[model samples]
Target chain A: MNTLKINYKNIYYPPGGILMWIIIFLELITFGMALVAFVYYGNEQRELFHHSRMQLNTTFGAINTVFLLTSGFFMANAVHQFKEKEIQKSSVFFKLAMLGGFLFLGLKSIEYYHKIESGISLDTNMFYTFYWLLTGFHVIHVIMGLVILGWTNYGMTKKDSDTITEDVEACAAFWHMCDLIWLLLFPVLYLIF
Target chain B: MQKSLIFVYGVLIALTIATALIANFMLVSPFVVSLIMGLAVFKFSLVTFQFMELKKANSFWKVSLTLTLGLIVLLIIFLK
Candidate 1:
């Protein structure tokens, strides 16, 4: 039993849990399926897609991409620091990560405001339909990730290293999912034109 | 962990800039869209392998996730 215990300590398993991977798998398929549908429709209406795509502001999308990537970077660092037994440093990095998320949301809101003010509603066109659904869905995930990160930040204040580790790892996984989804979306919606 | 993760992020940020430049400044070309989408796939790999800590996980995990990403990229390419 003692030998088994010592061996278990050295094994590096995935952070978070296996079920989170399952969820990630499912979530990615759902988005991919949706994107495929978008691509099909866009291909059928290539001219319309081209016209509507021009209405979008790549500048905002590019900036938001940076925001999310920076957030993901900080989140990875947060997990690393947490593993190193630096609770205070981990919390600081997590806060910075959250700040990036919030900034992305703020900029996204502005982008939405401009789109709405320009009279571009969800029903404006087929391309807009996919745009609202895909990006709005992503925004919801970002919100959910922020909430989880908030709880993870609170967990770091406690003295229990074991639970803190799990919380941080799980939070990092979820946040990175957000980043990954955005990577797919940015190229499809903003960069394809 | 810190140094390697930082390096991954640096590469990712640089790729982000490259994608933007290619998409915005480059004129219309048959291969442009393919290149942009390819960068997305590369970025996805970095995020999965480095940030998601899949690099330390079992091979089964890495392979399955990569296959899934590949399938998605293929679907996009077919339509593009």
Candidate 2:
């Protein structure tokens, strides 16, 4: 008689582990609630929201979306390479992912500069308030993700590298969270009123 | 696996472009808004299931995330 063996880790722990999944869930819920509120207020002041949204550059938003998505793809590839034991290739992909993050920040900074030059701030209006708060928080997340990726890449470079699969998976998960949040934010803030 | 990843990425980019075109060129209507939101949800799912490897995860995570996204989209549409 053959007994089936179960890998409990596969059953309970996700790609990045249980703890990271918890963080992702909480973050998603928080952002979802904020988006719902933004929509509610948008309905209340339709014209203001429309006008405020018009102040945004859709091209920049679209480009940024591409940036994050590309970065996410690269990060996924990095994890794949790492799992395949191609550490050098994984590091290259990691760098590419970081490049995407940097491009996103660069474009976002330009957009922010334009807004600040035009005297737009968190208190500018309800729409701008949501804009700043939501996107600003997201930018912070991207920055944190980049730092995590950078550290993970550095670890990969050491002769006796101690970077484990779980650590790399956690980093990728966090980076993808940034991508996921931006995916939600880009449309509501840029395309929709 | 790499081919599959590439396919997913292609689909995502195409969807993103379609969304932009619809929003920029088409007249604003209930249908248009719904379409854009729907596309956004589709893109989100691709990233979550494919890039984030949620497809390999347990059913609980998959179901809960799907429900969470659905709820968020419904609330936005209802409120809007």
lDDT of 2 by residue, A1-193 (tens): 3322324237577878788989999999999999999999999999999999999999999999999999999999998888878889999999999999999999999999999999999999999999999999999999999999999999987999988777888899999999889988998999888
> What level of docking quality does candidate 1 show?
medium
Stretches off by above 4 angstroms in model 2 are A1-9
Query: How would you encode candidate 1's per-residue C-alpha lDDT over A1-193 as one tens digit per residue?
Result: 1111111122234556677778889999999999989988988998899899989999899889999999999999988777777778988999999999999999999999999999998999999999999999999999999999998788677666445466667789999999999999998997674
DockQ of each: 0.59, 0.66
lDDT of each: 0.86, 0.91
Residue-level error in angstroms, candidate 2, position A56: 0.3
Model 2 clash pairs? Answer: none
Q: Which stretches of candidate 1 lie over 4 Å from their true place?
A: A1-13, A159-162
**Best candidate, lDDT-wise?**
2
